[model samples]
Target: MNTLNNHENTNILDLPNEMLFAIMNKLSKINVLYSLVDVNRQFDQLIIDSFYIHDLDLTRKSLSGDISPIDKQTLDRIICGKILPRINDKVNKLTVEPLSIERIFHAVDYAQLYSLSLVNFSQEILLRHIIDNAVIHRLMTEQITCLNIQVSDKIRSDFSVKNHSNILSLILFIRENLNDLTFSHWFIGLGLTFFMYKLSSTSCVSSTLTKLSIFVNTFDDCLFLLDRRLESLSTLIINIVQIFDTSANIDNTKLPQLKCFSLASYQRTCSYDSRIVPLLRRMPNIEELTLFLSVIRMESTYIDGIHLHDEILIHVPRLDKLLFSITTILYNINAKIELPSNDDIQRGFIEKEIYQADSYVINDPSK
Candidate 1:
């Protein structure tokens, strides 16, 4: 019996590095680091590998179905006391929430850190801990190359103008060494959704930024972000809350460097011809385009493949990929207008030699 038990029992250290790494990949980085670090000389050397320490997510992991409760005391003790100090230099990317942000940054100065993700931080905490703090500001401006910001606060009923200015200031502040950015703030509750952001006229004029994804309040706001000052911007993705004609005519500079563009808006626009078509024409050399738009047609029929081909595709000679989800809401004001069937939409696609197409038409008399 003793001999049989000895044969069945195998030490984890006996596993090869490849096998150990595969096993460690299954657990959260925190769990892996906490459970494995300081076990012995071999485990310490193994856990120090860049694969284990490169991207450290310090935020609390989602606890949907775990049987054991997270021991915050133990986690704080292990991470702050043991793990971060040893692996700080190897960390290239770090993600943190409000609770752990100060503690994590205070433990050590990550010399090789280039990317940072701030999640679920309130405006107050963000301003006090990160934005206004001198050390964090220097780290962001001098070292960070990629940044992602997601605010947790909901829009107040009496949303103050100071709050708007603070947001704009925050965006302007984090503009020195960044190459990629994704900034979004939205809250969905009580059968309502809010995503309100408008770029200021004096936005960042960076030559190094290559990709940007942001949420804007209006189509004009979207146009504001596509400033000629962003000389090296090659990819732009925007989710607009509303789409409409601008009140004033702005600069219509050709974006030759913009190789890819994606625009999504849930609200409907009646002026697709005047506003949206002209906007697409600005990107004369675009290679890839994606649009998710709702059109409220007042006098015209649905915007089909032919309209896209003539209006958008004809302008961009290099466009090799196109993906769109367009919905046209038709309303009869004076007379019953004839609307195209799904077959008609498909025929248009076939005529354009666009084989990959999915079209649907829904008629709602209530609207």
Candidate 2:
């Protein structure tokens, strides 16, 4: 019996550090590292040496208020010591939940990390901590690459002018970073000042951005901002809450590098500003275009003076594919209309021979 037990212990010790590291990486929570530290001296050393502890989720559950004091202390030590020291170089993704700006700043300041995701954050939280924190601003300049800022309607309802200024400051800071940015929010009540401020701030670093998405409540605000001359931008996605015409002052020639564009709008009050067709006229390099209309009325005009079909033929001559999602109109003044099938648009465009014969595939195969 003694000989058999000795052989089993020897086998366990023979396991390679790589295998041990893999096992630790599979843990769902970083705190689990503490548990493994107590398993054996070998595990403790292995966990300390592994660098794959880069994905961090700081939701409330992860930082449970019920955590024992000792555990909290231990976590603080690990974060301030090992984690923070390697933060700027090792961490690639980070998700933070709704918390005080102070706590958020504390986590971000020490991390000096990139790829930040903010969830359930309001304008107040952003203004208080992130905008006010100089250290956070400095860290963003050096390390951040991907950023996601999402705000709900309720949050917008509570936004004030001061809050708008705070947001502008944050945008200015981000523009300096010139990273991939995603802004998801309803800018319904916010005045034109917000758009002007944002555009002026972002224009400073438009040359560095590769991906940009704006979810706006009104196309008017977006069009006003897009009117400014952009230096560099490759991918663009716009989800508008209301239909509005693009500004005539827009300099389309500046968007020569654009490769992808998507516009989604609702149909009930759906109306396309004729300026869009002309704007599309300038994006000759766009390979993929998706236009989605939510509602349709029976009497609604199918072809406005914009000549969407004609513009596509002239400007985007090398277009690969066009996607159209439109609702059916049951009646215009009581006249019934059938919804056009998506495939119908595809077939119609193909029959017209509008797409380039050897253009790049619309749907990325690798994705």
Candidate 3:
């Protein structure tokens, strides 16, 4: 054991600089490398020369917080001189928080690249500045190929209008670039008429988008916003939460190329709305279906007796794999059922029979 330990230690010490650099890249966290930089001058030089600093994580390091002017200048120099050039070709993903659009634009301009994501960005001026400015226009025209915009409904009412215009301009930009796009946090009560209008009006859209995911706060919003046809999309994932009242029917004829579909709902009450049945029946090639009901309050007689059984299981016949997860909490009114286990519902009635027949045919056809 002592000889093996000594040999391993010697090998680590004798490892080539290139091998050490590769190992450092695989550490998976920046803090580990930071620690190694403190160990020896050789390692410090390795870290600095590798230009790993090109991936600036301003949010993670809290560099946006108030700082001394000298420190800020020094950081800016490091980013502009050492980081930006290395990132010119290699960096593709950029995430910006809602704090300040000016900071985001400044960073993006310095980076001279696109494929950006704005998370919970509620400020209108920042968005307007991007759309109105020439520098951003050039950047979007040349470099941007993927865009993600996230809006939170908890902000002030005015934020919604700002978000709407920003989305309109963003959609227009994507229509021009034909980029892969994702829209998160599609809350209810936000006027989506403008979006719908633009989507319907686009004549020769050349979007390279192959995947689209939308998260809606209510089923009504999902039905409304998702009612349009996306001719080029090949994969779609929809997540709805806390509200299941829908009158609009899904139009699947618009999405003929869809090969993957995922539907998930959590902490919400559900019912057997007749509109959803036809929608499920229309998705003829769906390979997987997952149903998750969590922290559901069972009060409405519409959901309790026969609706859940009929609406959830009896529909969606094309699903090759079905998964169900349910969670409920007891209250003073009645003893509520706990969350269902991983094995609660083995298979729906038809699924079980199909599985048995397939198993018998595969194992013993003569029998």
lDDT of 3 by residue, 236-341 (tens): 6767654454454445553345556666776445342444445555555666655555433343221221333465445444566655444433222454334322
Query: What is the C-alpha lDDT profile of model 2 across 1-367, one tens digit per residue?
Result: 9999988778654878778666656664455544554477776556544265566554434335321122355446654444445443455676655543344346535453678766655567665546566865665667677777765334243245446545644664565655577766444455222343244444433446677787655655555445433446677788766664444454555456778888887635434435455567777788888777644334443431133566464677666767655443323454444434445544555666544322111222242
TM-score of each candidate structure, all chains considered together? 0.82, 0.64, 0.61
lDDT by residue (28-63, candidate 1, tens digit) is 777777777888998888788888779887655666
Error of 1 at 254 (Å): 2.2
Which ranges in model 2 have alpha carbons more than 4 Å from their true place? 1-52, 60-88, 98-112, 152-162, 173-175, 186-207, 244-254, 266-269, 273-276, 295-314, 321-324, 328-367
Best by lDDT: 1
Better model by TM-score, 1 or 2? 1
Top candidate when judged by TM-score against the true structure: 1
Off by over 4 Å in 3: 1-58, 61-74, 97-114, 152-154, 158-162, 172-175, 185-208, 246-254, 272-277, 294-367
Global CA lDDT of candidate 2, please?
A: 0.55
Write down the worst ten-residue block by lDDT for model 1: 188-197
C-alpha-based local distance difference test score of model 1: 0.76
Model 1 spans > 4 angstroms off: 1-26, 36-47, 63-72, 155-164, 167-174, 187-200, 332-338, 363-367
